[model samples]
Target: MITDIRLRSQQLVNPAFNDPKELVAWMGALQGQEYSMAKWAVGLRLKKPDIRKVEAALEKGEILRTHVLRPTWHLVVAEDIRWMLKLSVRRVKLAYDSYWKNHGISEELHIKSLDVIVRALEGNRYLTRQEIGEELSRAGVIVGDDLVGYFLGRAEVDSIICNGVDKGNKRTYALLDERVPPMKELHKEEALAKLAIKYFRSHSPASLQDFIWWSGLSITEAKQAVGLIDAELIKERIGETDWLIHHSCARNVRAKRVIHLLPSYDEYLISYKDRSMALAPEYYRKAFNTFGIFYPVILHNGKIVGNWNKSAKQKQFGVESSFFIPGIEVDEGELDKAKERFRVFNKGGND
Candidate 1:
């Protein structure tokens, strides 16, 4: 029942969004470190999944990929980025403090690097990481691959720069102000409430701990956030656990036989600290590795049934599946439909 609610909440079943931008805004943010797979993650949630449409949203600046929520890359809507960053930047920086110190990125150096980066990207020019690193070197700032990555990430969290249109397959950075128009800024309290509402509205039947994990808020702050939105959410106790479901999602969602080829780090599994609702404990190791890497998964009726991999051969795209339970009964019609949906999302060729 929880999984059914999650399926509807996550838009994996009975998807209600027609536009990719609307969908991203609805989900708050999607894990997007894996560029290609993250596109499919958005596509799979559409009423009509279209990879081109998702990419268009990113290119047109309707949605932006940046470091937020946690220290990892997430795709957030352009309008929400400012307030979201303001709410989470300090926590994100705290998480990365040690790395910065170890890399000799003192406050002065951080300021200097941001200044150089802002100058380099001020004129609507998009620079790849290599190009940005070269600019830093030209400015007499010591630069390396790792240091460049840190500098760019720092710039992103500071709202100094953001993702620009890709150069072929390479990612580029653009001035955040240039890429996105000015938007209203929310105060800290308003931002926290908004974030809590967004997370629960899109990921309901989640616990306070799940919210804390996904939002990167400390336990005290996370609890305060939930309290700010307590009246709007419905608490349901399942066994010994208390789960919070948004009022809008507090209804029975009929379960159906649906197959989903969820990408690695999809919110369905990753957003929550405990994944037992969708992933069985016995199969945890198979779905995730020791290093916190989640593999692409096959979900049948809201439960992870197997794992899958994508392949391309001479422009032809294919999906290979490995079932956890051999000889498991599956509806061939549904499975074929799921694979066909993926093929269409892949544009019938390797991307």
Candidate 2:
């Protein structure tokens, strides 16, 4: 049986971290290139209120720009990205750089490909991989999709290239000089320490497994972080597993009957390896259903009781929700009752 408090901690302490300053530092950009891990961290939620706060945080330098951790874009803190990449690079090598080498991507070719992309984008402001490849082939590189796309992606990581206008079709590349520089640099160890502190601060009352899920960092990095952190924090051991809570923040942690319409990869839903606290075992399959991998869900009183979507029909607007856990199970009445909320929430959408 999942306790409401446990689930709240899992999703972040009920009235969750209302300060966007606290949460946005963990992720990177709004639009990421591949690296779903980075994309997932700064997920796109369905609610305007939720998005507004995240965007506000982006405007602040609390989140910095560094291609340190994931190969692709991550909206990590200005300080965290520098050290995060250094700490996690070896793991990245084991995962990608090494694997890419096996696939014929020598260090020389990697450098050459970036040159190819930069030469292509030198004069032209926006160009696709196909366009970039044409120039690369002319310059004597293979210019295949593997070469072109991967090279362009890495160029973004190198902080020389980034996404630009769609050109009425699909993605194109632009110089980072053209795109606004979103963040600054921080010392490596300072970044790591700060990242750990941010993780524990924003998402309090969490275990090491939770940090592993949230930052996508290895156990070594996670434990090192847990060791270096210094703050008013409390630990609660539920048997062999223990969770760290921000003593300063969680002091007045009050439980509220919340209906957080979290987005697909909302931090609360995705930032944990073992999610038993917020989601039951049986409902796991239902959450990550086979319907092409849908976004996770909204929790009524901490347990994910249903899922919701936005829609419009006949010029009238409405939000639809399917309750997973029966309402009678949680309450004596209608479980996960969202129909009335949707009706009220969607009225302004039509007019």
lDDT of each: 0.89, 0.55
- Candidate 2 — which residues are off by over 4 angstroms? 1-23, 26-73, 77-83, 98-102, 122-147, 156-185, 289-294, 312-317, 327-351
- What lDDT score is found at residue 118 in candidate 2? 75
Q: Pick the candidate with the highest lDDT.
A: 1
Clashing pairs in 2: 27-75, 27-76, 28-74, 28-75, 29-75, 64-77, 64-78, 68-85, 327-335
Candidate 1 positional error at 201, Å? 1.1
lDDT of 2 by residue, 205-289 (tens): 6788877766667788778777777554677777677878755443444566556444454556555667677778888766666
- Report the lDDT of model 2 for residue 8: 43
Q: After superposition, how far is residue 98 of candidate 1 from its true place, in Å?
A: 1.3
Give the TM-scores of the predictions, in the order they appear. Answer: 0.96, 0.70
Q: After superposition, how far is residue 1 of candidate 1 from its true place, in Å?
A: 0.8
Q: Which one is best on TM-score?
A: 1
Model 1 superposed RMSD (Cα): 1.8
Candidate 2 whole-model C-alpha lDDT, 0 to 1 = 0.55
